[model samples]
Target: MSKKVLVTGADGFIGSHLVEELILQGYDVKAFCYYNSFNSWGWLDSFPKSLLDKIEIFTGDVRDPNGVRTAMKGCDMVFHLAALIAIPYSYHSPDSYVDTNIKGTLNIIQAAKDLEIERVLVTSTSEIYGTAQYVPIDEKHPKQPQSPYSASKIGADCMADSFYRSFDMPITIVRPFNTYGPRQSARAIIPTIISQLLNGYEEIKLGDLTPTRDLLFVKDTVKGFIEISKSNFLIGHECNIATNSEISMQKMADTLIHLINPSAKIIQDTDRLRPEKSEVFRLFGDNKKIIEHTNWKVEHTLEQGLQATIDWFSEAENLKQYKAGIYNV
Candidate 1:
């Protein structure tokens, strides 16, 4: 029998891609999405009918322990990816970040412990490392939370660590750098850039052009998750899925603009700028740990990833979903 896996936040950008990959790998998937009044499944609604038929959709908030526990029942493995991830939104509502990111992760750990799940993978972000203290940050790098979103993730990582130390639970925190690809919302940098250019916006509004990021394609990130799950040697550890590369926001925008529209100009929108102290100036990740432990490799180059993202957003139907005129969050 195929191992039954439950993926929380399965309706989100990275979550949806992870779910699709899981299904293709022949895993019996239970997709846990945030419950909504309109019965919306977010990006999962875009999946083909045949693919959707294979997934067990469970709609419930991660903040609810009972709901999380119920979703984990009968599942052999759990992938906890549900969290409020927007940095700007975190500044406006830090309480929600604590409740959802930290508390939600706690609920997953508790349930996974109680249920004796074979493996539990907690999704983390490169944002937790804050500005790079050194080039090519490794797992040993000091965590500096510059934003509330990163702060909450740091707390959650600590909680996951506590569970591993106290109960000897099988858990692995898989941290991926900036993952960009299709079905991504406009809130992300790549989507924001592509959406505006695709909508015929000659002037793109952006913020913090100097800040750098270690960009990883969505497929590479998904492969990291799967490789980590299958590796028994990685229990109770944290691993980073990255390309060991860095790209400044301005350079990234230039690259995207060159690919989509050479005439487009970037304008610094004051409203889009992150608070100076809260901004993470650099994020150059080190992929040594994940590479040494797992059979995972970066199959997509940065150019390949960006071109794919641009192609997806250029489609008339996909481009229309985003309001390119407004600053998202």
Candidate 2:
């Protein structure tokens, strides 16, 4: 029998892609999506009916400890991806971030320890590093929580670490740099730019153009998770999935503008600007650890990934889902 695995937050962007990839790799997948009255599973709802048939759907809130434990009962391993991730929204609703990111992660790790799960991969983000004090940041780089969202993720990462050291539970902190692709929310720069331009906006509204990011395609990010899960060397360690390259917001926007509509221009929207202290000015991650430990390599270049994203968004059915006119917080 194939190893049965549970993936929480399988309804979200990266989570949904991970689920699809795991299924393709022949794992018996259980998707724990956030419960809702509308019977919606976020992006999972968009998957072809044939693909959805292979998945076991369990709808529940991650913050509920009992629900998380129940979801893990039969699975050999679990991928914990459920959390509040929007930086600006976290500033306005910090308490929710504490409850969902920290407490929700606590629920997953605590349950994994109790159930003696074979493996547990807790998702981390590059945002925790804040502004890179140095280039090509490795696992040993100092963590700086520049925003409330990053702070909660830091707290969650520490909690996962404690579980490994204190209880010897099998766990790995999997961090991915800025991931962009189809189905990404407008809160992110790539999707924000794509949706606005596709809608024929007069000016591409963006925030501070000075910050730089190490962008990773979503497919590559999902593959990194699968590779990490297969490696015992990654247990009790934090690994990054990145391209080991950087691009400033201005340059990225200019490139996207050139690709989509050459006549379009960019205009800074004050509402979109992150607070100076909270802003992460640079994030260029070192992929050496993941490369050394696993059989993963970035297969898509910046142009290739951007083209794939634009192709997906160009679909009329897909583009209609986003409200390009309103600025999403």
Candidate 3:
């Protein structure tokens, strides 16, 4: 029988894409979506009915241990992607980030230990490394929690590691740096720019264009997750899914404006700027660990990924989902 996998946060941007890809690969998939009043499945609701039919949707909050346990009951593997990821929002309400990111992850691994689940991949972020004391940051780099969101993720990562060291649980912390693609939240830099330009804003609003990032296309990041899961060598270790390159916000904005609207210009938005100390100025990740362990490689270049994202946002149906006129966080 094909392995049944439970993907927590499967209703989210990266999570939805992961679910679609997993189903296409013939895994019996259970999508653990955050429960909601409108019965909305986040981006998963936008998926074609044919693909939607193939998934087992489990509606529950990851913060609840009982709910997480119930969701993992029949699954052979677990991909815990549920977390409050917005940095600005975390600043406003860090308690929620703690309850969800740290505690939610604890629930998953704690249950996994009891259930004897074969594998557990806890999703992590590149922000944990802060400004990158060294270029091309590897898994061994000291985790500098720059924001409450990153701090919560750091706590969560530690919790997973404790479970691994104490009980020998099969766990791997999969960290992806600056993933961008279709269905990304407008809170992110790429989507914020794309949404405004497509919506006919001549002067695009932005903040902190000097910061550089190692952008990985969402599909490439997803491929990293799958390939890493296939490797027994990665258990109890952390791996970064990255392109091993870097780009500045200014250059990235120029490219997007060139692609969508040449007439557009960047307009500084004070509200969008991160606090001086909190902002992560640079993030260039080391991908050697994942490369050494798995067959994954970058299938999308920066241009290819940006074009794909722009193409998706240009569509009337997709573009309408984002409100470019207001700040997302």
User: Each candidate's TM vs. the true structure?
Assistant: 0.99, 0.99, 0.99
- lDDT head-to-head 1 vs 2, winner: 2
Residue lDDT tens for model 1, 1-329:
99999999999999999999999999999999999999999999989999999999999999999999999999999999999999999998999999999999999999999999999999889998888899899998999989999999999999999999999999999999999999876788889889988888899999889999999899999989999999998998999999999999899999999998999999999999998989999999999989998899999999999988888877888888899888888
Candidate 3's C-alpha runs over 4 A off are none
What's model 1's lDDT at 28? 99
Candidate 2 wrong stretches, greater than 4 Å: none
lDDT of 3 by residue, 29-121 (tens): 999999999999999999999999999999999999999999999889999999999999999999999999999999999999999999999
Least well predicted 10-residue stretch by lDDT in candidate 3: 16-25
Query: Backbone clash tally for model 2?
Result: 0
